[model samples]
Target: MNNYYQVSASYDDVGNILSITRRGLVPDANCFTPQEIDRMTLVYDTPSNRLLRVGDLAPTPYRPYGFKPGVSPSAEYVHDNNGNLTFDPHKGLMMQYNFLNLPTSIGAMSLTYDATGRKWKKDGEFGEVEYDNGVEYRDGVLEAIYAPDGRLVAEYPSGGNRSEGDISRFVAEYWHQDHLGNTRLAFADFNEDSFIEIKDNPSTGENELEITQESHYYPFGMGHMGHGMLLLLQRIGTCSMVLKEMKTWG
Candidate 1:
């Protein structure tokens, strides 16, 4: 590979051991997706320990601001040594954490943390700045959320905004993950206990952007959607994932 990365694996039948090794660092291919890591040569000793490693590879130094960002190539983001966001490309101070290093607020949407550092409350924010901490966990429950950029996108409950809301009158987000525990689908609970989805109007076979809404994509963002569609198969809900999958092409 151009980055001087190589992957080699060996399986020992006698000991039932499998070993894998890598040469160089492989940066996160995409921002929102789960990262692929090759940090250590895993040696799974099923019955015996016959797996052997011959070489060593040290990872390159980490330079957060200096290294190429996974999402935005035009601007850089800043984080503390603990990986808490202090500066975002568009929204500054993505998440403000307490002394314990737990998030207290995501942008203007205030959050309350329990004694154990668990977020228990979230307040709405209607500021001009858009913020998403790439996670939405509150009141000891995780939610259906993901952030391709620095902003959050998820299904909203009644009175909750599609873009921002801290409080929820909804259930904890549920997920179905791949074999590697990669979440590929996020289902959201909307108003009246009904689900959130984009459907074609019966009168007109047009994909209404949830009524009076439209989304636009640039050339670069579109490129990923083209290829990501195959990977974004129908993974949830009736009349949901199938339609949303086609939306990528539209």
Candidate 2:
């Protein structure tokens, strides 16, 4: 059966999205019924027009159920004097920014930039990454090389045999992006078959493509839950560029 879904939004006088509602037709016994799947309410600072809360009606004393009033946790946003997002209740940490408005640190992660204001180094719980001349190094080992457009063109395996040559030593990867330039798919031909492999996944009980990674995002560019490809992209230095382009990360 074809699945049907509808989305509607209410806006404030200042053009701010006050609320969004999503509904879908789902099978209910012998008939299909329209059911509310999700809803989000946005609250903003009137003067600054900065988003203060999402999926909630008020500020302090968060509602137990957010938009549903009793089903999910609400998210709160806090900004600093410089308009930098200093805190997010969901993230559970305070973010710090540099004089240039570039993020300096978030939780246990720290970032460094070159003289030209380009991000060159990152150290965090995951590992250390160094960006040099479009190539990325993870924990002092060559990791990946990026194209001029910031795409992950190739990846290097640590301690791999190099006697064959550079081309033979690295894996070539490709990225499929959506209209908003978010990475929706990442893959590499591992078996040299020239065809993308597909097989049933025992864990998920579903057919899965043999790809390096796949990701899906919300309308505002926030990735959906359970898609961990963002970590891989961060390792390859692509996530930063994507976030910058989307203007979602600072």
Candidate 3:
């Protein structure tokens, strides 16, 4: 029998989601008793239609940098005069933006854009990525090359010391996307075998595909935890580009 979950949402007059409730089947029970798995309440600025709070958190006024401390420090969303989000409590830092409203820095990571406002470089604690054309270089090493359709076609071996002609270099990857163009699976021939392999996963006690990575997302693009391997190629620059494209085409 297939188990299923039901998600219901309550929306305001302007179509803003006020609350979302997820109900699922009770474990080890034959009877159909819906058990609540998750619930979230969203609060918004009515006039501006901006999301102010999520869950049971109270909406607090925006605070600028160097503001005096009050009785308590609560999670608050801060926006600049141009309505650009400058701070998010979840990130725990004030984001700096350029004149074009493009984010320049967030915490330890810093970004640089070209003359046309296209992001060309990202330097962070993990590593640095330089975007040139459709290719990405990580710390002065060829990391990956993307297709015009935004599909990652190839990736090079890790480590900055490896050369382009190295025997362990250049792995081809294929992506399988859903109807909404969400990437669901990424597979590659790592062993150079003629066939893609499948093996038993000891952790989950299930047969798993030996693929590079796989991901499942919620309706709003939030990824599900513990469902697949870590996506090594996912980066903030790519996410920002995708979001910008979505906003433009939506």
- Top candidate, metric lDDT: 2
Models 1 onward score TM values of 0.30, 0.64, 0.66
Model 1 per-residue lDDT tens digits across residues 1-250: 2323334556555644254433332244432222222333334323434222321222333222112223442344556666666666533347777888877777767766667766546676532222234455433334435444122334456565444455344433434444544444544443334645555467866544232222222221211122222234334534456453446666
Off by over 4 Å in 3: 1-5, 23-37, 56-74, 148-160, 163-167, 200-209, 226-250
Q: How does candidate 3 fare on TM-score?
A: 0.66
How many steric overlaps are in each model, in order? 0, 2, 0
Best-to-worst order by TM-score is 3, 2, 1
After superposition of all CA atoms, the RMSD between model 3 and the true structure is 12.9
Top candidate when judged by TM-score against the true structure: 3
What local distance difference test score does each model get?
0.42, 0.64, 0.62
Better of 1 and 3 by lDDT: 3
Model 2 per-residue lDDT at 106: 90
Candidate 1 regions off by >4 Å?
1-76, 81-83, 126-175, 186-250
- Assess candidate 3 and give its lDDT: 0.62
